[model samples]
Target: CELSSNASVSPGNFILHPSCDYDGLIPSVVFFLSFLLGVPGNIAVIIFRPNFQHLSSVSQKLMLNLVVSDLLCLLTLPLWIYAFLYMWTFGLVACKLLTFFVYCSTYGSGLTVTVLSVQRYLLVVHQKNWTHQMGVRLLLVLLWLFSIILSIPQLVFRQVTTLQNKTLCQSQYSSQAQRITVLLVEGLVGFTIFFLVVFSYTRLQKKVKQAAFFNNPQTTRLVTCIITSVFIFWVPYHFFDVLSAAAIFLNNEDLLQFCLTALYTVKALHAVNSCLNPLLYAFTSHNLCCKKSLSPKI
Candidate 1:
C-alpha cells in the first residue's frame, strides 16, 4: 500500500513523496500524545504506590499486566513518529523486532483484559476466587506465550521497504491469500476477546449493581469506562482489517485503496486506546485499585 498525500506527483516524479503533512501528521501527533500521557501514567501506576509488584489481588495483578502491555505499545511511539516524518533508518532487524513488540503488546493487552473480566465474573457472580495464586500466574504465563506465538508472522514478514523512494516499515506477505489469512486471524481473535469481555460485563451488570465491592460509584464508573473504551478505540481498527481482507478477497481495488488510505488513521485511534488506560485504571481507579474494601481479594 502507498502513502496518500495532498501534493500531486507529476509524471515520473518519484522524488515528490508524501511528507509529515496530510495523512502522516495526524497519526504522528496522536502517537506523540499517547506517549507523553501514557508513559508517566503507567510508570506512576507501577511505582507510585508501594509494593506494586507484590500485589496479591487478582484484579490488581491483571491490571498491572495491562499497564505493562500499554507501556510496551507506548514505548515504540518515538520510533514510529520518526518513521512517519522521515524514514525507517533502523534497518530490517529493528523493523521486525519493533513490530513484533507491538504485536505482542497488543495481543497481551486484549488477553489480559479478557482474563481480568472472567476473573471478575467468577468473583462477583459466582462467589469464587481463582483458588490459588499459582493458577493465575500460570494462566498469565500462557497468555504471553500465546501472544508471542501469534506475533511470529510479524517477526517473519515485516521489513523496511522503499516505497515511492521513501524507506518505510510495513508488512509484506507472499500473496493476497496470505495477507487475507493473517488479517482474518487477527480480526477474529480480537473479536473473540471483545465478545468474551462483553459477555462477562453483561453478566456482571445486574450482579455488580447489587454486589458490595461494586457498590462504590467510582468502581462502577471505572468498570463502565474500561468496557466502553475498548469498543470506542479498538473496534474500528479491527473493522478496517476485516474489510481489507474482504477487499482483497473480492479483488475490489477501490475498496482496498480506501482501506489502505484510512487504515493508518484507525491505527492512531488504537494508539489513543493505550494512552487512556492509565487514567482509567490508575488515576481514576483509586477506589477500585487502591481501596481494600472496594477491591475484591483473591
Candidate 2:
C-alpha cells in the first residue's frame, strides 16, 4: 500500500528520525543455526520413519512430513541470510523462486501440523477408521497438493527490485486489496486450525484424567512441547502481520514502515521455528530411545 522503504522522503530534523539500531548479527547466527539443525534432523526423521519398526505408525508419517517441510524451509536460509546481507543479489526470477519455496515450505509445515491435530482429534474423539482412509501415501499426496495451491500467490506476486544499487526480494501485489485479501485468508485459516487444536486437546484432557494410556507422561510432554513451539514461534509474527495490515488500511506510512521492519525480525524468527521443531519434537525421542517405540502417538 504505502511506497517501498527505498522511496524518497525528505530528510527532516535528525532528532525527529532517530536511527533505530537493528542487530544484524542475531539474524545471521540464528539462520546459521537453523540450517545446521534442520538439515540433519529432517533427514533423520525421513530415514528413520520407514526403517524404524517402532515408530512406523500413521501419525509418525505426518510428523515426518512436518520435519521434511521444516528441513526444506531451512535449506533456503543461507540464501536468505545472503539476501539480507547483500540485498538480494540473486536476480528477479531467483528471488521469486526462493520466496516461493520459503512460503510453500513454511505454510506446508503449518498445515501439516494442523492436519495432524485434526487426525488426533478424530482418532481420540470419534475413534473412527481414519487411518485406512487417509494413510501416509494419501496424506503425502494431499500435503503436496495443498502446499502448491497455497503457495501460488507467492509465485504470482513476488518480484526483485533494485534499491540504491542493491536488489531486494519482495512481494509485488498488483493491488492493496489483493494483499489484504491474502492476509485475511491466512489469518482466518490459522485461527481456525489453532482453535480446533486447543479445543480438542482440552476435551481430550478432561476425559482421560485417570486412564493409564491417557496419563502417559510422554504423550502429554510431546503435545505440550509442540504446542508451545508453535505458539511461541508463530503467534507474535501473525499478530504483527495483523497490525501491519491494519496500519496499511489506515494509511499510516511511518508506523507501517516501522512495523514492517519489525516484522522482518519476526519473520526471521518464524524461520527459526523449522529448526527448533526437530529439537523440540524429535531429538528427545531419539535420545530416550523412544523413537523406536510408540508409547503414545500425538
Candidate 3:
C-alpha cells in the first residue's frame, strides 16, 4: 500500500512497487465493452457455427480453437474490470490463477491466428497439405502446451497487493533484470507471431495476384479485414510491451512511465480485436446469412 524509496520486491515479500495507474475510467469502460461484445459474439459463433467457406476444414478447426481462447480472454474481463473500477478483492491465489490463464489464452490466440494464416497460405500458394486430420489434433496439443509454458512466469510473478487501501493485482519483479527479461520474452514471442501472420498473408496476396484462375468465392475482403484488425488492434499492445522493456533496460523512468501509460489504450484496442472477428464472420458468411431466408413466419 505504501510506496517506499528503497523497497525490496523479492518473492514472498509484500512491498512490490506498482506500475503506473493503469486502471482508469476509460480503460475500465473499454474492458466492460469488450466483455459485453466479446462474450456474446464468441458464444454465437460456437452455437451457430459460422463458417468461412474459403478456409479448409483444418483452418476451421483452428478457428474453433481460436474462439475458445478468445472466450478465455473475454470471460476474465469482469474480474479485471471490477479490479480496475474498484479493487482486486480476490486473494493472491485468484490473482495468480487469473493472470496465468490470461497469459495462456492471449498467447494461445496469437499462436492460433498465426497458424491459421500460415495454413491458409500454404494451402493457397504452395498447395501444401502438411497436416491432415490426425496431425491437427497433435498441433493443437502442442500449441496449448507451449502456451502454458509461457504463462508460467505470470503465475509465478503475479501477486495481489494493496495500493492506497485499494487492492491491486500485478506482476512483481524482484530485480530490474527480472522485469526486463520477462517483458522481452513476452514481446519477442508476440511480435514473432505477428511477423509470421504478416508474412503468410503477404505471400498469399502475392500468389493470388499472379494466379490466372484466382476467381474463387472472393473471401479476400473478409480475410484481409481479419488480418488488418489483428495488426491494427494487437500490434500496439506488443509494440508498447517491447518499448517498456527497452525503457527499463535504459533505466529511463519517464519513458518507462509513458510506455506503461500507453498500455491502457492498446489494451482496449486488443480487447476490441478479440470480438471483431465474430461480427465479421457471423454477418459476412453467405451460407449462414442466407440459411434462414426461407423460414416461414414463426
TM-score of each: 0.86, 0.81, 0.84
Q: Which regions of candidate 3 fall more than 4 Å away from where they truly are?
A: 1-23, 52-54, 212-220, 280-298
Global CA lDDT computed for model 1: 0.70
For model 1, residues 108-160, the per-residue Cα lDDT tens digits are 88888888778767766676767677887898899999999988887776767
**Stretches of model 1 off by over 4 angstroms after superposition:** 1-21, 50-56, 211-220, 284-298
**Candidate 3 clashes between residue pairs 3 or more apart in a chain or in different chains:** none
For lDDT, candidate 2 versus 3, the one ahead is 3
Candidate numbers sorted by lDDT from highest down: 1, 3, 2
lDDT over C-alpha atoms for residue 209 of model 3: 58
Compute the lDDT for candidate 2.
0.60
Name the top TM-score candidate.
Answer: 1
- Per-residue lDDT over 105-203 for candidate 2, one digit per residue giving the tens place of the 0 to 100 score: 777788777776666555555554254635668877887887778767767866676554555566656666776666666656556656666666555
**Which lDDT values do the candidates have, in the order given?**
0.70, 0.60, 0.67
Would you list the clashing residue pairs of candidate 2?
none
Lowest summed lDDT across 10 adjacent residues in model 2 is found at 9-18
lDDT of 3 at 296: 11
Task: List model 3 lDDT by residue over 119-171, tens digit each.
Answer: 76776666676546889999999999999998898787777765666576777
Separate clash counts for every candidate = 0, 0, 0
